[model samples]
Target: MNGASLATGQRSLGDPSVTFPLWPPQLRGCPETSTAEIAYPVEVDYAYEDVDTALFAQAPGPDLARWAPLLPPLHAPTLGEGGTPLLELDGLPGVYLKDESRNPTWSHKDRLNRVTVSAAVGAGAPGVVVASSGNHGASAAAYAARAGLPAIVLASAEAPPAVQSFVRAYGAKVLTMPAEDRWPLMRRIKVLTMPAEDRWPLMRRIVDRFGYHPVSNLTVTHTGHPFGAEGYKTIAYELFAQLGRVPAAVFTPTGYAEMLYGVWKGFAELRRLGVAETAPPMYACEPAVGAPHARALATGTPAAIVELGPTGAYGIACTVGGHRGVRAVRDSGGEAVPVTDDELRAAQELLARQGLWQELSGAAGLAGYRRLGREFDGPVVCVGTSSGFKDLETGRERVRLLEDVDVDVSLDDLLRATDA
Candidate 1:
C-alpha cells in the first residue's frame, strides 16, 4: 500500500457518525443499518484537505495507485485496471462513452475486485469468497489469483457459460447454484450440514468465522465490500481529466449501483476540494424487468425490493435495491431510468455497428440516455460496463441465429452464402 494514502477510516453511509477502523477491512456491511429486509453499506473516508491539490496538475496514471490518497488501502497487486478510454462518439454530438470493457477481465468489476481482494490480503485471510452473476465473480477470481489466494465463487448456473469458464480459468472453484441461493449460501454456513456429497467439499472450506474475506454482500439487502466501490472513484477522476472539466451528466449501469455511487463520490470529493464547482447528474440505469432503485426513489425509501422479470440484460437486473444507489441518485439530482431489453438491444447494436461491441447490459447507460431524451448543459458520458462477449449468447451465436453451414469451395458459392 502507498504510504501517501490519506484514508482516515470507514463510515457507514447510513449514519456518517458510525465509524470503524480502516485496517482489517470491513468484510461485513454496516451493523447499524441491519434490519428485517434492508441494510446500508459503509464507505471509506479520506482526509481530503491533506491531499496535495497539485497532484491533479499532472495527468492521471494508468493505474489506480496514483490516486491512492483518495482511495482505500490497496493491499493487493494491480492487474493494470483503470485508465480506460473516454471515447467521444462520432454521431452522438458531445456524448462520450466511458468504455469500461477495456479493463482487465474486460469489465468495470476489475476496479472493485482490485480493492476488495486486497482487503483479504491485508486482513491476512487465506482466501476470498464472492457471489456473482458473471462479471463480478470472474474479476474477483482473477484478482484473488493475482494475490496468490484461493477463491471460491458462488455463481448462478444460469449465467453465461463463457463467464463461468472464465472464473474457473483463474483456478477458482465455481459452485454453480440458483440465483436466489447464491447470496444466502455466501452469508451462511448452515448449508454445510448437508451430506458431504450433497454440500460439496468446497462448501466446507467456506467458514467466514475462520478468516475468509467475503468480497460480496453479507446482509439482507446488498452492502458489498467496504472498499469495493472506493476503487471506482478512479472513473470520475479519469473522466474529469479526459474532458478537462466535469461532465453535466453521467449515466451508469447500476447493478447494486456500487460503481455509480463510487463515481458520484469521486466527483463529490472534487467539489468539496474546490476542484469543481458541481458534481454531474448521476443516472442509475437498470433493466426494465426490475428497477428496484427507481421503485425506492418513487416510494421515498432508503431501499426497496422488486420482483424480477425475464430480461437478457441480467447483469443489472437486480431484484433488490441498494442504499448506495439511492444515495447516488438522490445526492446527484439524478433519475433512476429503466430501459427495456429492446432499448438495450438497440443501443448494443448501434455500438457494435460503431465498432464497439458491448455486453447487452453494458449498453444500459446509452439506452437510458436515449430513453431520458434530454439535452445536457455540458458533455454527457454514458458508461459502458462490460464487453458484449460476456452476454448469454456467445459472440458467434449473437449474429447467427442458425447453425453453421459449410459453403462450397467456389467464388460463386461464397458470394451466394454471404448474399454478396
Candidate 2:
C-alpha cells in the first residue's frame, strides 16, 4: 500500500521532476575525507523513513515518473535494472545463488558502473578513465558506450585473456600497461583529463542540454549514481518477495566492494523502512592471493595496504581496500573470508553439479561459504558474479583431444561391466 504508484504518472521523491532532494538520505553524508590523497565528494543521499515503512514498496525505476520532481533536474526515468533472480542450489542445502551474471554486462559490476557513469554524466566530465583487470573495466566500458562517452580502460596486459577481449569488445580504448603502472596511470589521467566546458558528457544529456555531443570522463569511480544503486536494491526486494523473510547471510565476491556494498545497503534500507524484519550479515569473499580487505578486517585496520599477487580469480584479486568494504562488513557484523584457487575450482564444480556455470572468481563466494558454513546458520546467498566466458584470458584449460577412441556401448557390455 505504501509503494510508489506508477499509475498516477506523478513525479515525487528523488525524481528530477519533483523538488525536495536528488540523492537518497543515506548517501547524503560526506564521504570519508580521512585520506587526503583520494578525497572525493560523497554524492548519494536518502530520505528519513521509519523502520516499518516497507522501502521495497517503492520501486525507483518504475516510479521515476512519480518521483521525478523530487530528484535532480537532470535525472530521468530509468530502466528497471535491479530486479534479478535468487535461484536455489539443488545440491547445496540452505545455499542460494544470486545470479548477477544476468545483468546487462554479464556481471555484478553493472550495478556499480550504471551509477558511476551517471555520476560522470551529471558532473559533466569529458571522458572517463578506469584501472581494472577484469569486470570493472568491462562494466565501465559498456556503460560509457551506452552513455556515448569516450572511455579509456587502463588494464594490465597480464589480465586474464577473456577480460581483455571484453574490454575491446565494448570499443573502450584498451591501454595495455604493466600491472605496476596501471593504477598510477589511472590517477594521472584523472588529474589531466577534463572535458570542454561545452561538452554534454552523454547522448541523452546532449539532447537535453545542448545539441553538442558530450565527451566521457575517464575518472568516474564509485557507484554514486543515486538511481544506479537503486538497481541493486532490487536484489533485496526480490529476496523479500520470494522468501517472505530475510536471509541470514549474503556472501559476495569482492573487488571494488560495490556488489557487497550494494546488497548490504539494500537490506539495511529495507530493514530501516520496515520492509524486512532484519538484515542479513554481509560476508565478503576474496581470493587469498590478494585479499587486502580481508586482512584489513582481521587486523582491525581502516584500510589494508599490500601488494596484489596473481590469482586465477582475477576479478577479486584486489589489494587496496575501499571504504564501502569497511562499512559493509562492519554494518552487518559480517566477516571477510579468503579462498584459494583450489577452493574456487572446487566450488565451480559444485555449482556445475547444480546446473550453474560460474566463473572461477564468481565461485569465490561459494568457496568461502563452504569453508565457513559451519559457523553460519540459516539461509545464505552466495553471489555468482559472472559467467565462465570471462576466464578465457588465463588459457589454463588446454586439453588434448583424441581423434578416435575404441569403445563399445551395448546392453550386454553394460551388464557384464556391472557384474564384473
RMSD of each predicted structure: 4.7, 8.6
User: Total clashes, candidate 2?
Assistant: 44
lDDT of 2 by residue, 261-292 (tens): 76776787676766567899888898888787
Error of 2 at 270 (Å): 0.7
Pick by TM-score: which candidate is best?
Answer: 1
Q: Residue 138 lDDT in model 2?
A: 88
lDDT of each model, Cα atoms only? 0.83, 0.60
lDDT of 2: 0.60
List the lowest-lDDT window of 10 residues for candidate 1.
190-199
The numbered model that scores best in lDDT is: 1
* Candidate 1 RMSD computed on C-alpha atoms after optimal superposition onto the true structure: 4.7
User: What lDDT tens digits, residue by residue, belong to model 1 across residues 128-168?
Assistant: 88777689889999999999999887765576778878888
Off by over 4 Å in 1: 1-3, 177-209, 395-416
List runs of model 2 lying over 4 Å from the truth: 1-32, 36-43, 49-80, 178-231, 375-377, 392-396, 399-420
